[model samples]
Target: MKAILAFAPLFARLKGAMLLTLLLSLVTLAAGIGLLGLSGWFLTAAALSTLGSVFNIFAPSAGVRGLSFIRILARYGEKLSGHDMTLRLLSDLRAWLFARLFPLVPLARRFGRGDLVSRLLADVEALDTLFLVALGPISTAVLAGAAMTVVLALLLPGAAVIYAVLFFSAVLLVPVGLVLASRRAGAEVVAAGAALRQAVLDGIDGHQDLVLFGARDAAVASSDTAARRLSAARRRLGRNAALAGAMVQILAGGALVGALLVGFVALEAQQIDGPLLAGLLLAIIASFEASAMLVRSATRLAGAAAAADRLQAIATSAPGIAEPAAALPVPPGGEIRLEAVRFGYDPAHPVIDALSLAIRSGECVAITGPSGAGKSTIAQLLLRLVDPDAGVVRLNGADLRDVAGAELRRRIALMTQDAPVFLDTVRANLRIGRDGADDAALWQVLEAVQLADFVKALPGQLDAIVGEAGRTLSAGQARRICLARTLLSEADVIVFDEPTGGLDFEAESAFLVELPALTRGRTAIVITHAVVPASFDRVLELRAGRIAERAHVPA
Candidate 1:
């Protein structure tokens, strides 16, 4: 509940619209009750009217028509305002959540992609019911119930007392019981639904591997099991809601009978007329319509609460690295230095230990080591993806920690083996490097990476759609496009981590041939186990978190 309330500030932004919607909803409910009451009174009075008797037909007839018009108009306004507010709120919330998620990336990868997607898409969507189910309905029920009770009391105080008791019992007590009963099951439903979604997404993403590994059947089975569990949870919640609804209906029936009895007694004592009795009875029935939605709203409360908790887990989790309160500006020259830097995912096992290195401005260096020698870790530290545990990594004489991550990244771009290629047009992918780069600049970078000819041959050229993760392009083509993107950046320093991991001899050689031109007048760090190009100014080998060897490569 507390987690759900954390969005109060967001709700505050639409307070004006929400208040308007509430007012309209109240009017709609009131109009409905008035219409039913007026119609019943007019019909009964017209039936009892004798031939040529003096009956005020015009007034009641106009009242019925006016109430009907009000009901229709108010209902339309209520739905229109309510849905408009909901759409705006949902749009704002999605953007806000993504903004929060942006700074925590790479470290946020600890939560699997499927799980994160589920939270972003499904969990956030579940909150739509917060306004539609819980807030609007509950508020309308309270106000309408109170207003009905007062109106009835004006006519028959005894009938009003009975109506209030039954109304509260149905709206408050029964719903509370339903909430209690559905809380655990509703939570289970939400959790199971997320799990099922995750399983299905994982299967789709890894279906090839599953099939090759003879595990496709197992994957299918897992998804099926999750679906069954989700279905069972949903069924449980449905049963609770139905039971609560039945109880409300029973209470409403009792209120109707009580109203009838009270009306008959009052009429016999000459306290009220026949038409007034009929009107009051019909109004009591119509009032219960507003309270009818309360039970369903209460049942959904648990699921909404569960979704809020899931979203809060991501919202409140601290980022991998904290931003400095006062960040230093990036220096003009790209000089990187690591002094006694030590870090590891686990405290007991350090990846980089007491490692010290320095690269002069605009120097090209190749760092080579076998697998798990902290080659990639060095790139991560320089980019400040993960902070060093012990010593300092500095850029242009300022500690990386003292500079904002975005600023540091602006000065130093990292291109990895698995650089993500989004499912968008080729122009969109290239624009990620330089937001406003024109077609000429794009072609220049593409040519530098020797991929311009292939792209130009495509039917759509720059506008060509690249499939998810660049699956539409060959592996070597994808890697070169990533390099072209990196080259498009105006960063003074660039780091490549196994950039040619899956390339063949010819592709690697072609990339190496262009290495000198690509790295000219820029600080470049190539971290890989593959053959280092002879054009590098210096080569260093890392072993067990230490620089074990250093050599100069002849130009």
Candidate 2:
């Protein structure tokens, strides 16, 4: 499950016009150069043989222009087709990357800020080189080099032999060496860039905490270090690139000098005609420039691969829980049972272990424990966010894993203390629990949560645009709105984790008083550190990682 490159099959599946466009473009590029070389050879030969001849003058004039037109058409086709394919493929790559990422968020959020930031922005961007540019050029470079090698050998076997070696040196040898020299440096550079990206995310998210603690200056200093690290890595990698380029240039210059030396001797000895020597020499020079482009493309490959590796890592990580292929149908009752369950976010540190509990339909239970003593873990178990490492979680005797995902989640409504308020309208946030709810339906839930009056008094009422993370609302109001969202679900089972955490005495009182009505006929599990009034219900406490005790309400 940890092998990240498992998703390569998805990329290898792009079909239809995408592959065709890439092929057509590369063919056009190689063919255009070949035609241009032929035109030059023909024009030279005609003039040399027919000096002051009538047919020679007209043929060069008419035939050269016709060849020029054909070349321009191929060049145009190559550029357009290559560009079209790259753009479309870029879109497909981004979507696939995003889908791979979404399933990992709950697990990945456990990573440090630097790692997450880099994965989202820096790593994703690094892949631009692979999809948008290199794919086509790398293909064309190999194909064109092969065609040129054959033509040179046919023209003059000795000269072509020399050119073929140079082509291999430029296309393969030089680039491979450069990549080896720079590969580790390139990966380091990407890591540093991700660190810097994480620093930016932290600075923004912790802005209020930094201000309160008078640590703004310290935070900025940390960010500066991250930025410097990124810049230094880039500079070091750039040096490696410059060094590789220098080596390629030296090889290319020497090959061209060799061609000139060999070419002049052949002409002087009258082994090949002047026209044929000129044509072969020009072809060799053209191959050198193309190879230089190929080298630049190779250097970018290290950066691209570094990005792809991160994306692959996300695609292949294991999920916290795996659903079963089949299960017995769920019973009509919303009753749930946990038997000898043990679990942990980290194996070395168990959060809930050997915990056993049961809740009949229409029962309301309040779970209480010291902070970090697995109070929230019980609530999480009911929602099936994380399955117990050992033991069973069942709904009316049907194993949770066997039930369909949507069916399991739909009948249960949960509100966590750390739940983020989305950037949406007041109504929109409430509507998430019941998407097609009308105004009357929304008001009913608001009344149950004791927020009906406040919502009605708002200038925009249901249409009020809440700020990002519900910033425009006070803490208690935000919490109540979230509670209202839970109420609107009308689910068979409801689990509330510290729902009244931010509310004042007045708001808290109303919430506690009005909430029991909503839980009637539905199984409810409430997790809290605070004690509620002695109501007619069961109470459970957790210690270490297990359920410590269960008792009836003392009153």
C-alpha lDDT of all candidate models, in order: 0.87, 0.72
Q: Which consecutive 10 residues in model 1 have the weakest lDDT in total?
A: 106-115
Candidate 1 local lDDT, 149-188, one digit each (tens): 9988999877999999999898888888887888889788
Please, what is the TM-score per model? 0.85, 0.73
- lDDT of predicted model 2: 0.72
User: Which one wins on TM-score?
Assistant: 1
Q: Write the per-residue lDDT of candidate 2 for residues 478-530, one digit (tens) a residue.
A: 88888888878858888989887877777665565555666788888888765
Q: Give the Å error, residue 319, model 2.
A: 2.8
Which TM-score value belongs to model 1?
Answer: 0.85
Top-scoring candidate (lDDT):
1
Name the runs in model 2 displaced over 4 angstroms: 1-8, 31-105, 108-110, 124-131, 207-233, 269-280, 324-328, 337-358, 364-373, 389-394, 397-407, 417-491, 498-520, 526-555
- Work out candidate 1's RMSD over C-alphas: 3.8
Instruction: Flag clash pairs in model 2.
Output: 353-545
